[model samples]
Structure formats: structure tokens, C-alpha cells
Target: MSYSATDMIFDSEGYHQDFLIDLYEKLLKPRLVEEKMLILLRQGKVSKWFSGIGQEAIAVGVTSILQEDEYILPMHRNLGVFTTRNVPLHRLFSQWQGKINGFTKGRDRSFHFGTHEYKIIGMISHLGPQLGVADGIALAHKLQNEKKLTAVFSGEGGTSEGDFHEALNIAAVWDLPVLFCIENNAYGLSTPTSEQYRCEHLADRAKGYGMESHIIDGNNILEIHQKLSNIANDVRENPRPVLIEFKTFRMRGHEEASGTAYVPDEDLAHWRERDPIVRFEQHLLDRGILNWDWAEHIKCKIKQEIEAHLAIASEDRLPEFDETIELNDVFKVTENQYFEISGEISEIRFIDAISDALRLSMRKHPNLVLMGQDIAEYGGVFKITKGFVEEFGKDRVRNTPICESGIIEVAAGLSIKGMKAVVEMQFADFVSSGFNPIVNYLAKFHYRWGQNADVVIRMPCGAGVGAGPFHSQSNESWFTKVPGLKVVYPSNPVDAKALLIAAINDPNPVLYFEHKALYRTQRQEVPFDYYTTEIGKASLLKEGTILTIISYGAALQEALKIIEEEKIDYIDVLDLRTLQPLDTISIFASARKTGKVIILTEDSLFGSIASEISAQITENCFEFLDAPVIRVGSLETPIPFASILETNYLPYQRFREKLKELIEY
Candidate 1:
């Protein structure tokens, strides 16, 4: 139902008329804060400002109903939510100023700060990813049988993203305790709502997911508070997701840098007249719950608080960069941590070894959860997670919709709440769809905020089995370039089990690339017990003096076969289990000893791991090199479907010739 200023309900049995005064005061604080922030923006004190001018009621109303321990995932414009969450004014000012006293310690200078103690998550620049993260937190609460629910905020623009659809679907199917709040502010940056979606109301999309949906008058603070309180309680008592669309308007531009030139003057005037804060304040006065004297007093108190905090925040020092940032600091776990082994040795395929490692990890860590498409009941397309559902039950092993972006972010959200999530990408190439969450959010968490996203993304990669371009791809090189991510590509069943175990236990985000080609092709003796290989250390498979062969994943087998068949006595083979923190000491030492080097990988020749290894070795061991560093990799083309074309594409014989030429050089 539509709510007008005069028609709005000011009194309810649950909340007295006095509550309207409190809500109006709460709404005024953020508007004053935003006005101050806009001034700071003009004065160069803050780099940017996103005003929640007309939309303050959405945050204040929703937060008013939330329990102290319940979480709220807020966006940049949700200043009202931050205020309600008891975030100190000075801390918010410090974050805006990029000061050391800020929550992010000057690493970020936007609305990107969250406190685990406060149960609030700061927003990443990307809009839609937080929805999935909320789903993950809600999932954790559900599994733990907690009475808490999670609320995530997004805008109308975010509904266009695949993550939004995916998160809503997962939450609906699994019956998660999550409230998806969409603020339809009529525009996404410069694009109007009419241009963004064809649907009449964004909430209508929730019906397709079989979820409860509501459309509320966002400008009515009292009505919003009353409705959200009941909805929040319902979600907490009977765990299921609901999507609420706030019919609001954005009074300001997207940011201070962006002017409101694109918005029609008439439309702006219409929303200006319906300003939630003004409307709420007038309603309170008309109801005789507040007077001009009380309103002025509240405004003065809030303005003084903002100015006082801004003064303190202005004096805060800037963060100094430290040069001694080590790999272990980012990874969170010490590389040299001792892992005790206990089970018998048995022969197992590459995929089964990975599956066994996951099982062992889950059995040991109760917080570990598995999520992927068709993974729970279907046991995954490759049967790697076969029989996992019967063992761990559906709560632990979940089957997600085909939404990689949502899946990865959900895993990230779970990680934030001290839950370890193992997210399986059905195919490695599909990672491109979810690359934003992986690179922008998950990979940057530890570096920016010193928070470890203790999640492992299992990517089934490589192209030898002729699955074509869509299914088969060696995308490890793409992630190896990202700074905070750990890239692991195992060569054998033993390393597969060991590395997966290590990645799971590690506190950083690890991209564990399991070769689809080697799933069932190779078998080796793998320990039944738990063990972890060093994440940043390379293993010396064979030792020699004349030449050093560096390879990993499927290419390591080719390197080994060539060495054995040719009876090469002067060759040393190094399996680079982890790619990002390349074992440079071992690589340089091996290069210096051998006097020659060859790097091999299954990826395309251009911008491959082989290129990285070759460049690094040449730079460090240039004086000792007897010959130029050589690289052997697949041809630079899409992986073909036909066996003959695929074989020609990934020619092992040609790779062997390259290795021979390097050895004899």
C-alpha cells in the first residue's frame, strides 16, 4: 500500500509514539553526516561521498529491528545503518580520511570497514557480491542452529547481476535465514530504473525463486520499522529467505564526483518533496510527538558530535607502509607448521585423492562446508564428491545453482564468520564468470583489512581430455598474477592430497587447480592419513647438474616421462606445487647448479606460468646460465574438441623436442 505524509501510521502497539521521535532523530544524524561529508568532499578531506539522503529510512528502520548479534551487510550509502550499529563518528571520519585510526588502517578510503565484534560487514566496491556473502553467513547460522538472521543491502542496479539471482535461489532452495533488501533508488549511476529492468517491480523476480517478497514505502520510517521487525522475527523463527524491495529515490548523484545532470529536474523535485527525513520529521510534529524545539536540539546535538569526531579524525596519523610484509603474513598460516600423519598408504586416482583430502579435512574441522553445482546429490560431474552427502548430510555438502559469482562470494562470507568453505567450480573456465569476487573481494581481504578469507576454490583445469574451450582450460596463470591469492597445481596423487589439505588448513584464499585430464588417468600411492605439503615450496622430483626442468599440474608428467625415456642423467625436475609464491630460492639454486633451465606448463605459450618461471630464473641466475631460459607450453588457441586437433594443440612430442633442445644447448 502507498504511504503518504499525512496517511502514514505514527503509532503502533509494539512501538510507542515516542519511538517516532527517536527514529526521526536517528534519520537526521545521517543526513547531517552526509552534508558534512559532502563539504569534506569539496574541501579534499574525503575523496568521495555517496549520500543516502532520501534512503536513510531503509537503513535506520531495518537496523532498528535487528538483534545486537545479528549481522547487516551494508553498502556505501547506508550511513544510517552504520550510525545505528553504533559505529563511532570519528572512526567513520577516519576511514573517509584514510587515517591509521580507521578500521581499514588507511588501506582503503571508502565505505569498506567492518567489525567482527559489531557483526556488521563493510561493502566492497562491487555491489552484488554481498548478497551471496550474506547467504553464506545465514547458512553458517542455520548449520550452527543459531537464532540469528543476516540482512544484506543492495541497489536496484545490483539486481541485474547474476550474483543476485544466484544468492536468492540458493537461499530459497536451502531455506536460509537471510533478508535481501533492495533499495530501488530509480537509478544505477546515470541509468534510470526504466532502462535497468523490464519488470514492473524488482521484488516480483523473487516469486520465480519461490521466495516471499514485499514492496514497502521506503520513505515511511515508522511503517518500514514495523514491517521489517515482523519480517525479521519471522525469518529468525522459521528460517527462510525473503526479498524486500524498498521503493525509494536517490536525491543525490551516484557520488560527489558525479553531478545530477542526467536526472530530470521534475523527477528530482518529486523525490525532494518526499525526502524520508523531512517526511518523518513532519509526521512526528503533526502527530504532536515532537516539536520544533526538540527537533532543533536533536539536530544541534548530532551536528556537534559530527564536528567533534571530524576534529579528532583529522588529527589521526596516516599509515606507514612496511617493507617486511612476508608471505606467511598474507597466508595467515606458517608454512613450516608440522602436520602429523596417521593412515595407511593406498593407491588412488587424482580426483579421488582430492575427494579424500576434503573428507579428511571436513571430519577434522566441523566448520568446513562444501558448495558447488550438482555436488551434493549428483556427487559432482566427475564423482570427486561421490557419497559426500550421505556422510556429511545436506547441511554441510550443499548443491548450489549455476552461479559462480554467488558461490565464491558465499564462500567468502562464510570465511569471514570463521567457517572454512571449499567451493568447487564445475569447470575451470567457468571461473571467468565469477572473477570479480575472486580478484576484487576474496583475494584482497587479507591485504586490505588483515582479514583472512579462509576459503579454498577447487578449479578442475587442463585440456588434454578434449572437453573443448568451455570445460577444459588451464587458467592458473590468470590467478598467479593476483597478489594475495595462493595458486596451487599438483602433479601427482600424493601432492594433490597433500596440497588440498594444506590449502584447506591455510588462512588465505587458495586457488587449488585440479587437472581434469588427470582425474582418473593416473594412480599413485597416497596416504590415507592427514598431511600437508608446504604451500610456497617446490618439490625436487629428480636431481641432476646439466639442466633444470620446472613444471607442474599435467605438464609435470610429460617432463618426467621425457627424462625417463631419454635416460637423461643430467636433468633436474622441479614440481612447482604453488605458483604465486614461486619457490624462487629453490629455483635459483637449481638454475645455478644446472647452468640451464626449461619451464613447462599446459597453458597457452603467451602469458603462461612457463613465461613467469623463465623470466624469474633468468633475472636471478642470469650470470650462471649456460644457455637462454626456454619455455614449453600449449599452442595459443582455444582447446579443440576433436582428439586429433586437441593432441596437435597440446603436442607433448613437440614439448619433448623443446626440452631436448634446452638440455643440449
Candidate 2:
């Protein structure tokens, strides 16, 4: 019944030094083994190494308080955090060895190893980037009413990054149940903390962001455990973030093969004397909780286990690539040019395929949630998501406030917890508002840390319906430039449904394009059974002998009409569903068949998808081409509200007419 002052103040009688000592022997020793990994790297057993020696107590201490199902986002130096969370030891070692058994399947290095099924999100090396992601995970748990807390670990140096500030500000604003643990070890890769920051403690930075802050003695394991346990419980009850700053030291250089010659002698001596592992071991012995012989036995056992796991990991078979052979990146791909639609002139209307797909997809996936301005209740101005709110409840079909950045940020959070979120923008033109969530965060998070976001962002795009420049546009070229994002434009209902399902199921982020004009005008035969089409593959719509006509979305139907009327020979019409993967194999195969290429789209002709495809084809299939790659698209002019002016600016009959001329040429 007796409790220490620290225990009474935090109401953490459940936390004890005995548990701390046991955790240190089991979890903390792993850090010492990982420290040995740095030397392994120098011996060429591993490629690169990031050291986290002085900050072991903070990682181990904070993680001990979290439940197994709860999540944590540890930065590069928190391998101990993963160890505490029961991440597979062999997998961790395999990651450092760059083997298939690694967490990322050899796609990434050791630093990105937390995405395992153990519920730890993963670690991000791009200093402080994981904070926002952790905040997002926290927000998601709060929204879902899940009984979980998120713990995000960062170094004192990472606290200075812009993303760190953005995460803390948002976490405070939302009162998310997240704990931000800063391992302030005085040095951020050679530069001292005093040099990088003016504040006395990194925890003080929390007040500026309207968050509770605590400065813990990183060397004292019991104190760290009690403090973190208190904050974890408080966060669970109040659902708000708290900042815990652990004042520690880095016993080793910042990275493998790095020097600390600049480190002062007095500072080095002071930090060494306060080594957390040594101090905690002495604390246990002094308290008679553990004997010296028992402590020595624990250390020996940990080393033996690390070596055994490392050897097993080295010998373990990598994940079979055959399992991933059919796994294609989620992008629209074109297949078989033969027309699937039977009969001539079955009511044709010009519109983007994006709209039809959204309509069909909403009917398929009940869990598929869509949110945007005027989307659910208003059915969206484009009416692409019409009847969605009525069919799916408001919970699944949400109407977000005019906060694009916040909406997508929350969407990412939802997706992290296994929810599929399809966020829409009223117009592709206003994507600037959400660009921060898109380009800087969403697109880079997976590549930076090997995480996945099953999110679909539908942008009503392209100009031609006389809605004006802002209302009608196809700006997907801007999004496709980013890696780890699947961009697609469905040319018809079939591609639309297939790509929509693919985007919904895609592990990475997907940017779905729905032209405003295509909302209700275009219709096609999609099968009744719910089926998904693969991304990164293309559909060949028509066969012509002279030139291969490559187009997507609204332009594909236009090209089809023109080729049918003109009776073009062997015209290979390719419908690219996903832009990121581009179906390059299919494209090149078709290009070789026609020996001439013509790219068409409803967007502006200059610097469009056509331009990129042209350059790629010219470089790879130059010998096969009989003529220069041709392109047809909208004129480089702002779309006006007047139908006449809009028609003049948009690509339509002009594109169809030009393709006819090119076939003759």
C-alpha cells in the first residue's frame, strides 16, 4: 500500500522499479545489441547504421506503459521501442541485413522497420516527419472511439522540424490522445542542443502549442516509467496530447562511422557517469530488487538471444516474390482495343469517366467513405456522389468543412486504422488548399517510412462544360509527379469501376480524376457483380494499323467515335486507368504495332500527360516510330463560363479532327 512521492503524485502505484529493471534487462539490453549492430555495419555485415545509445531509457520506459494493440511512431533511433512492442527480432536484424525477411521485404533499409503486424506504425528517418503521422493515428483512434493511445518518439533535434510543429499544433487543436516523447540527448549529429535551440527544455516548446509539458530525468528508469504511465492514462481519459522531454545523452556518435571529436571532454565524462542502463542496474541492486549475479545473467541472456536471432534472420528465407508477382501498383491500365459496347450510337454524351466510377464504386463498397465540400448532402455540385448520403449513412458519407488540409489529414488518420477514405475536391482547381496534406505529407510518408494510406482523392477535373476555368480542369499532371501516389483517369464506365475498386483497395495513396463534364453525360455497361480492375494496366479499345491513339477519361470516347467514323486502319486505342505505373509495357507494345503515336487528353496541350508519354516513347521506341509523336488537347486558355468560349478553349472536336488527319498523314 505504500507509494513513493513520485508514485503518489502521478497516481502510478502500479508502476514499480522491479518492473522497470525487468524491462531494462529484457528490452534495454536490445539497444546495447543494436549498438553492436553499428560495428556490424562497419564490418560490412550491414549497409548503414543509426545509433541510439544514450536514449534507451526513454524509448523502453515509454513503450512499457502502452498496451499491445496501441500504436507508436518511433523515429530512426527508437529500435528499443520496437523491441519493447514485441516486434520480431529476426525481422529487425534481417532489415539491417537488407534481406527479404526484413519488414519492408527488402524494399527499404533498416530504419523503416515498424510497419509489421505488431501494431507499431513504423519509424521515419526524415527527422520529425513521423510526428504528424502519429498525430493522425491518434486522431483516428479518437474518432473511432477506440481505447488506444499513440506514442510518438523524436529526438531533441527533430523537435525543430516544421512537421513537428505542424503535428503538435494540430494535436493541441484537436486534443488528440497522443504522447510526444522527445529524447533530448544534447547533440543532434554533432551540433549541441544549446546551439540548435534557445529553450532550457524541449518540453517547454509544448506550451507555445497549447499542450501540457513534462521534463523527465532520462537516466532514472523508475521516474521515466512513472511519468510516462501518468501521461498515458491522462491522455486516455482526456484525449489530449502531452509532451514529455527526456534529458539524456548519446553515448555513441550520431551514426555508424561518425566521430565525436568535437564533443567536449567534461560533457562526455558527465554523460558517461549517468548512463541509464548502468544507473538503473545499480538502482535495482541498491533496492535489493535484483542481485549483481542475476543482472549479469540477464545481460548474458540478451546477448545470446540477439546473436541467435541475428543468425536465424540471416538464414531465414526472404518473402517469396511470387506472392507479389500479381501485386501491381494501383494505377489505371489500358487493355484490349476491341470495343466492348455493342451496336452503333447507343446515346453518347461527353463527360469524364471519373464520375461514373465514383457512382458505381459507392454502390459496391459499403465501408467506402467519401467526404468533401457539398459532396454528401448536396451530392456534390458535380453530382458524382449523388444519393451517396441517402444510401450510406452520414457517418460513412461525411460532409467536411471547408478545410481541405484538415479533411485529408483526418482521412489519412482514418485510413491508418484500416478504413478506406475517398475524399473529393469540388474542383481539381482548388487542390492548392490540400496540397500540403497531399504532396508534402501523404505522398512522402510511405516512401519515407514504408507505410500505406488507402485513400482515394477524387478531383472533378477538365474544362469543356462551360463552368469556367476554376470549375472545369484536369490538373492530375501535377499530382502524378509525386512517387508513391497512384494517379488515374478513367476514360469510360468500365475503367472507372475497375480503377475505383483498385484505388479503394490500393495500399498506397490514389488520386482519382473525375472531369466535371463527365458527371452525368457518359454511361457504359459495368457488370452487376462487384469486381475490381487492376491499376498500372491499360485497356486497348480499338485496333488501327496506322497509329496508336492513346487517351484517357473523356478523350478516349472521343477518339473511339472518330476512329469508327473515319474507318482508321488498325488504330490501337489505349485507355490508361492509372497514370503512375503508366502500363509502359502495354504502351510500348501498342506503339510498336502502329509505328506512330498520338496522345490525346481534355487538359491543356502544353506540358500535359501527352508530353510525358511522347518523351518516354521517343526515348524508348524511337526506332519504331515512323512519325513524330503527336498530341491533341485543350488550348492553353482559361475556360470561360460562356458555352461558346468554353468550347473554343477546350479540346473536343478539334482533337477528334486532328487524330483523323494524323491517321491519313
Candidate 3:
């Protein structure tokens, strides 16, 4: 079944000469367009240009074998894939020009645009996160038993990223139908391949993950097409992952802004001699498939088309300043129908209540899925998902690799397909590993592009168990600063169960912070029925007129205990459930009534949630304030492992003393 280069060109029965000529012409278009973009770059019409001059053949050849229904998560250099996907020439030009008619509507000017209609995902600037997203898409297809595969493209440099390894491991373990193609251009920006990785070949790394691998000459389009065609078929049928490495070179620098000074002359000269476009053209001419005149005609026609599209796109209007208004739809949650339960209300621990909420949600919505490390059979590190695998099976309740970034990426992809995913972060501190996707992609997708990502990322936060810095950290402030994200932290079991139900049904991304200290400590009578507590709403735990005290998560428990133990009848307590969309109405009402306020949190004092609340109260309730607003937070040092040290770090006695001062003032 093997065919040589001569067999592909000369044997009419195996390969049609006309199809090769057409593909050659198609490949020429992206190169010409890229060259034209360089011209526009010099003329000050375009802001930046990331050239794909030397890698068009791989893009076109791989995309040619893909069906229209299949998806490709393409990077900035894969212009040929966009062209083959039927993306209009004028739209591409409009995007470069930052016009309103562009894919991002002038919000972004690079290749960060994708249409759901085209089944292509426009990549973010981050390199390897998309591989994990592709894994989720492939998982969706596998779950539905569809005969579709997902193709994700990256460079050899991306292979060095943690996300790359995590994604490959997940794909191999889950047997997902994904084609990971790496363009080995020998450089990651300015670093050479030798400095970037020590491996002999990028595809060789696939063996460690138990996946199939292939290495191909990128300049040979016929060979690439043939291999992809056969491999893609096998992947579609058998539902497993495959890795393909395309050995190519970058003729241009990373961008036009970065010239060829860093690259050696000898290397550039050697690669120029084997230019893919030139080599393909010579091959066509030698085989009599294309004449000199016909090739020239094709180039001229493509140039004219590029010019026409450029002219039209240049005249397209730019986005207005008024259109930059902040969008709040991403924080909006849908109201789910509440079902009543006649049975007696049961008092349960915070962790068990959360698990019951998840089980109820899964039973109500068939599309709801739970994914995390040790969450399947072992039922998570805290056993929040204990017995879920037995009840819902492995397909619905899944265990994932220890990849924080990959978990978020997969959840994002699942949300795109209208499925809800609940992600369990083993510890809140580990969220730093996945911070890029949560802040950049998941937080911005709804605002920039109108895509709703219905995902819940459960973060087990706060320090009361003496787990030390790595295991015990309250990281809610990191996400509260980000727009288009909902931050929820509950103080009691009732709100924990209700808010989790609401977060799962929400249309946007939600960061649900469950306090590790309160997981088994706090028990309350929780409703057994499926219900949703309103997001962006705070619960007024105790109402009073003296000093107003606001807190959330584990600290709220301390605040409540201090108020009752001290018999402070005039002090009010407010459990601020959602942080980002702060309950300003209730906060201001309490602040105005008390004329004094105190904010409490388990995070460090600097840049803490308490600081934000204090500032907002000073701004709006300044006239009503009789005393300066005060904030009580954990010490600036990391949470210590020693029980006494940790207790002193966030001592409830300090908070009690601070509240007495505010009340007396």
C-alpha cells in the first residue's frame, strides 16, 4: 500500500494530476496573501503580521482530508486551513485592518477569531492550551458515538509546555479521537529547537503516552495528504489519539516586527533552497501537470483577488467607542425550575451537601458531567464525589489527569457544545497552574465573542486545617478582579448546596470556593429538593443597627460566633455569597444603618477582598460613616503548617477585638 514520490506524480491511477495542480494553486493563495499583508504592514494599514510563508502546505494538506463537520483548533500561522474552510478573503483582510466587519469586530486584530458555523476554533496567544480543548471536543464526539475527529495544530515549542503533556496524557488515557499535529519549525520564537527540547523528534514523545506517532516531510504536500487521509480514517473508526510531526522551517521571523537577524544566514539559505512552494511548483512543471504560462496565470489571478478583497476590507468601518461598554450578560444565570421535596429536611455536613447537590443536578440534567482527579472511583480527595461512579457510571463521572490547566480547557470546550461541566480543583492553591485559561480565555470569551461557557470550577479554599501554604490558600481575590466571571463562596451548608445548583445552571463561568475548614465542621438543615439560590445575592444572616460586619466562607462562621457569643444585639452580619457581583444594595443599606462597618476574610491583608469592600463602603457610604471602615484579614505571611502559628495567623480573637473597637466608635 506504500507509494513513492514518483508513483504519486506519474501513476494516474493512484493520483490525479489535475487535483494536485488545483491544490498547488490553492496553497499559493495564502502565501501571496501573506506577502500582501507584509506590504500592508509597511503602509501602516495593518498593525502586525505573523507570517505562514513556509508552512502553507501542511495546513492545506491536513485540512483537505477533514470533513466539514470535523473541527480544527488552529494557531496564528495556519492561514491555509482558514482559506480551505471557506473563510472569505475580505473577512481575513478586514480582521487584519481591525474593521468592524472582521471576525472579532475590531476587538482583536490577529488570528484570534473563529465562527461556530465553520467548526474552527481561533486560538489565543497562549500556545498549548488548545490541545486540552481539542481533547474535550473529541471526548464529546466519543460520548455521542459520532465518527468525527478533532485536529489541533501547534509548533515544536508548544510541546515543551505542561499543558501539552497533560493534554496528551488525557487523550491517550481516555482513548479520544484527536490528531495532534506539530509543525517542527526548529524555533520557539527566538530559541532554537536544541535549547527548547532535548528529544530527538517531537513525535517520539508520543510513545510515553501510548499513542501512535508519525514524522513526515512537510514540504511534500502529496505525502502529507496521503498520510493524514489514512491516519484520520483510522482515528475516526477506532477512536484513539495520534501525533504527527511536520518537519518544516520558518522562512520569516516570528513576526514582521522581528527581522531575520537572529537566524543564521547558512540556515536560511539551506531552507530557501527547499522552499515548499517553489519545490511544489517545480514538481508540477516537471510532471506536465501545470505549464509555466498556466502557473503564472494562477498567481496573477490570486494576486488580483487579494487586491480586490483588500480594497473592500480597507473601507469597512471601525468599531465605535460607545460599543466598548462593559458586558454583564456573562454573569447572568438562568432560573431553573425548583422542585419541592415533602420529606424532612436533613442536617448534613458542607461537603456532603455539595455532593448531594451535584447528584441531584446530574439526575435532573442528563448533560451535566463531573470531572476531577480521583473523583471517579475514589470520589475525589475529600470524597465529595464518593459513590458517583457507581451511581452515574464512569462515562458521566470521570477522573482526569493531574492537570489544572487542562481541566479548565476541557470544561471550556464542553461548555461550547452546550454541556455543563463541574471541575474539582484538589486544592484552591493549585488554581494558579490553570490561572491563564480562567482569567484570559474563560473570563474573556463571553465579552469578546458572544460564547457562553456554562462551567463551574470548584475551588477548595481557606486555611483552618493547618495544611500549609500549598494546600491551604484563599484565592478568590484573583478571580474577583476579572470581569465576566462569577465568584461564589458560601458560609453554611444550605447556601453551599443551593449556590452550587445555581452555579451549574448558570450561563457563564463560576468559581465556587468551598472552605476546607467548613467542609465537615459546619452542619445545617439543607433542603433535599433541587433548588437554586440566586447568584449575585447576599444573605443577611443576622440584622442589627449597631456595627455592620461582612464576611464569607470560613471567616463568616467566626463572625457569626463572635456576634452571638458577645451578645451583640446591635451588630449586623452579612454573608456575601457572590464576590464579583457584590450585593451593594444590601451592603449599602446595612452600612447606612450602622454608620460603621468591618470586613473580614481569611486571605492575606494586602489586596484582599476585605480591602475592596472597605473601599466601596467609603466611596458610597462616606456621608453615613461615623468611623473609618476597618478590615480584618490573615497576616501577610503564607499559611504556616504549625497549628498554633496558623491559628495566630487568622485568630478569631483578633477579629473579635477589632469588631469591639468598631462597635464602640
Candidate 4:
């Protein structure tokens, strides 16, 4: 239902005169600073500014009431949120100027940066995914038994995103302490509310999800502060998610460059009369708490404060980066740390290795959490985690809805808060559902803000099980092209166990591709105890100088069998356990020695990891090569379902032929 704070009484915590003046200052500082930024934007001193001229009350009111340690994930227009939290003004000005002292060191622009010190999580341009991140931090707070809440904000337009629905559903189901705040300024860029949603108010959408929701006069500072303060306290103590819609209007364009030509002149006039700061100023003046002389004095003091900070920030040097500074912080360097397994060897399959790694990690690290679709009592679709929930309890072994985007975003929040999370995609193809969060949020987090996303996405991928097009895929190449991500495809159980354990410890996102076909196909003597494997390293499976065959995952196993069956032992075989940060040293060393190289995999030939390997070998080993590098992979067409068509579509026989052809050359 729509909520009005004008009729409510603020009995005990009555709005004191000082409290009124404090809120006034909070609202006025951002308004004046934003006006200054518009001028700077015109002069080209600031790259851009998301003017929150008319919407200052929401940020100030909500932020001023929140506990200093409670995290708030804000939008680009939340300049008042930062100012209300008492963050250094010079640093904020530095951030706007793209100086070296900015939160992201100029790696990001505008307010797109998070700071642990300020308890603020930055906004991603794709606004909705951040709601899922709120679920994660709130989940962490609940798991730790901490009486804290997380507040996340969005515009009326962002509520239409799938992540908004997914996050709301998950938070309500789990009863997480989160405040899903929406500032309904009536337009998403240029699309009006009539085009955005069918509901009367965005908070009304919460009813379908069984969540408590409220609406306030977003343009009224007293109403926003009182209602938000009461609701935030209630959510923190009661432990449930709630929705709050504050009705305000953006008095300026979305960005200074984007004019408000689409916004009707009458609408702008209507909102200006109800301007937040002006309304709050009149509220104090009518109560005799503020005088014109004192008010002009306050505005003048704030103006001088902003100008001084801006002048100092303008003189600051821009970021001067180098190869080391640019390359570093993508992923935290982890040393090989584990106990050596002794004489007793256990025969294990690929699936067992993955299970062993997770079981060991969950016990070793109390902060480690696992999230998947049916991972709790159902044991997952593959039954790999059948007994996990019983051991780790429902809190650690979380069975998430089929919301892949929420899974990645939530995992990123956990990692950012000094914890680790492992997400299991039932089938490798489902990674597509979570791709945006993985690539946009998790991948660029460390590079953009020096915040490592320690998330491991276990992709149960590959073909040959007759699972058809949707279930089967060898699409590791999709991630090999992205920076700040580590991709590892393991052929055997030993590597799978060690790599997964290493991935959990590595302070970055990792895609661990486990071929579905190889899960039960082979058994090997793996370690009975713990051990760690090095990432970005390759191993020589066969030593020879005649020809070199580079392959990984199920393809490498098939290649080994074919060569042994045909008595072709003169070829050198290299197994790349890690696809990203590829073992160039070993690859080039073997390529130069053998002269002829064959790169094979199960992925499609065009734009495959095999193609990348072929290009690298040719570029670096051209002088040593006696013949052109050969690449063998699946056909360009979609993977067929029929056994005969599937067999013909795969590269099993083609790879063997290519090996012999390279040998003869």
C-alpha cells in the first residue's frame, strides 16, 4: 500500500531542531555540488556528472539514518549518500576529476566505485544485478548472526530487470535483512513509467513475492528520513526483506550530455515547485528553526567548501599507469599450499575428485559457502552433493532458485566481504544465464576497484552424452577471451581436485570446466590426502621430437588412446591443464623441438581455444616449425542428437587423421 509520513507522529525520536538543520545541510550540499559539477562538465574539467539535483532527499534521508557499518549499494546519482556518510570531500572531488586519489585510481569514472572503508558498494551500469549483491551481503550478515541490514537502491526503470525479481524472491524466501529502495522519478532514460511497468507503484510489485512494501513522498526530506529510519531499524531487528518506493522526479537530464527534451515542460515545472531541498528549507522556516540569514549563510559555507575541494582536486595529477600497475591486481597471486599425499592411493573418478575438493575445502575454510539449484537435499542433478546439506547444514549448502545471475552476483558479494563461494551450474550450458554477472561484475571487479572476486563457477560441460544441444557444450573458449578470469579444463581426477582447491583459494573468479563425458569414463590413482595444483601450467604427457600434439580435457584422453593403439609414440603430447594464462613457456619449448604441432579439442573449430593455440604457436615458433600448425575440433553446425550424426559431428576420427598428417609433414 502507498505510505504517507506526513500524518505519522515521530514521538520519542522527535525531529529535533538540530536534526532538522542536519538533514537540511545533507540535502543542500549535494544540490550545490551537483550544480558546480554541471559547470565543470561544460568546461570539460569533469568528464561527466549524473545530476541528482531534484532527487537529493532520498540519498540523504536513507543514508543519514543507516548505521555507519551497514553497507549500502548506491546508484550513480547517489552523491548525497557519499556526502551524508561523511566520506572525505577531497577524495570525492578527486574521483570526479579522475585524479590518482580517486576510489578506483581512474580505472572507473563517475560514482562507479566501491570502498570497504565507507561501507559502500559501487553501482554497475546494469543496475539490476546489484540487487542480488545486496542479497549476498545480507545473507552473510544473517549467517554470521550479526544484527545488521544492507540497503540497496534502484530507479523505477531498474525494477523491470530480471535480477530485480530474482533478488526479491531469494531475499524474501531466505528472510534476509535488506532494504530494496526504489526512487520513482518516472523515467528510465527516455522511457516513461507507462512503458516501464503496468503496476501503479514499483513497491506494489512486492506483493506477488510476499514481501512487505511502502511508498513515501521521495521529495519530502522529513517523510523520507522518518519512514526510512523506522523501516531500516525494523528490517535489521526483524530479519526480513522489504521494499520502499520514494516518489521523486529528476529535475535535470539523465546525464548532462543527455538533454531532457523528451521530458515535458509541465512535468519539469511540477517537480521544481516540489524540489526536495526547497521544500525542506520551507519546512524549517515555517517551524522557526531556520532564518533567511542563517540559510544563505549555510548555502554560502557549503559553496565555499565544495569550491575549495574542487580546486585542490583539479590540481591533482591524473593516473600514470605502467605494465606492472595495469597487469597487477587482476588476480591475487597464490602460492602452492597443501599437504603431500602419501603411499596410500585411492582409485577415483573425475566426479570423485571434484567432490573431494569441495568436501575438503568446506571443512578447511569455515567461510566457504556453496550455492546451486538442487544442491541441498536433492544432492544436485548429478548427485555430486547428495550428502552435502546433511553435513554442512542448509546455511552453507544453499539450494538457490534457477536464478543464475543472482548466483554469480551473490557470490561476488561474499568474496568482496572476505569470504569464498563456489557456484555449481547444473549443466555447462546454463552458464549463459549467469554470463553478465560473471563477465561484467566478477571479471572486472578487481581490475576496476582492486576488489578480488573469489568465486569458482563449476561448469559441468562437454558433449558425447546425447544430452542434446542445450545440455552439452564445450564452450570454454567463451571465457578464454575475457581478462581477469582463470579458465581450467581438467582431463583427470588429480588435476580436477587440485585445481578446484586452488581455484577456491585464488582471489579471483575461476571457471572450472569438467567434461561430463569424462566424469565416470576413467579411473586413476589419486591422492588419499590433500594436495594443491599450480594454475597456468602445462604438463608433457608424452616426450618425443618427431611431432607435437597439444590438447586438453576429454580430447587429450582420446588422443592418448589413439596414439597408443596405433603405436605412434614418436609424437610429443602436451596437456594444458589451464586454458587461460596458458603455459606459453612449455608450449613454445615443445613446439620448437618437435617443429610440427597439432592443436585439438572438442569445441567448434572456428574461434575455439584450439584456434588460439594454433595462432600462438605459429606466431612464436614460425622459424622452428617445419610445417603449418593443424587444428582439429567439432564441426561448425549445431551438435546433433542422433548417434550417427553426433559421431560424424565430433572430431574423434578427424583428430587422429590430423595427427598422422602432421607427422608426415
Lowest lDDT sum, 10 consecutive residues, model 3, at 1-10
With a 3 Å backbone cut-off (N, CA, C), the pairs that clash in candidate 1 are none
How are the candidates ranked when ordered by TM-score, highest leading? 4, 1, 3, 2
RMSD, one per candidate, in order: 1.8, 6.1, 2.6, 1.9
Candidate 3 regions off by >4 Å? Answer: 1-13, 329-344
* Comparison by lDDT, 1 against 3, better one: 1
Q: 1-665, model 4: which lDDT tens digit per residue? A: 33233432222247678877877898998888888888878988889888888899899988987899999999999899999998888899888887898998888888889999999998989898899999999999988888999999999999989999999999998899999999998888888999989987788899999999998888877777777788888888899999999888888788878889999998888778777777678767877889999999999999999888877887888999788978886766566676566656789898988898999899989999999999999988888888998899999999998899988888987876788999999998998998999888898898888888889999998888888888888889999999999999989888888888888888789999999999999788998677778888998988988999899999999899999888998778899999998999999999999899988899998999988889988899999999999999999987888888888888989988877787777
Worst 10 residues of 4 by lDDT: 3-12
- Residue 70, candidate 2: Cα error in Å is 1.2
Candidate achieving the largest lDDT: 4
The list of candidate 2 runs beyond 4 A from truth reads 1-20, 169-175, 191-210, 314-366, 371-413, 425-452, 463-475, 478-485, 491-502, 505-508, 517-548, 554-577, 580-596, 602-608, 615-626, 633-664
TM-score of 3: 0.96
Supply the global lDDT for candidate 3: 0.86
Q: Give TM per candidate.
A: 0.96, 0.77, 0.96, 0.97
Q: Best TM-score goes to which candidate?
A: 4
| Per-residue accuracy of model 3 over 485-579 as CA lDDT, tens digit each | 88999999989998998888777899999998899999998877777788889988888788888999889999888888998886778999989
Q: List the residue pairs that clash in candidate 4.
A: none
Once superposed on the true structure, which residue ranges of model 4 sit more than 4 Å away at CA?
1-13
Candidate 1: minimum summed lDDT over ten consecutive residues — where?
1-10
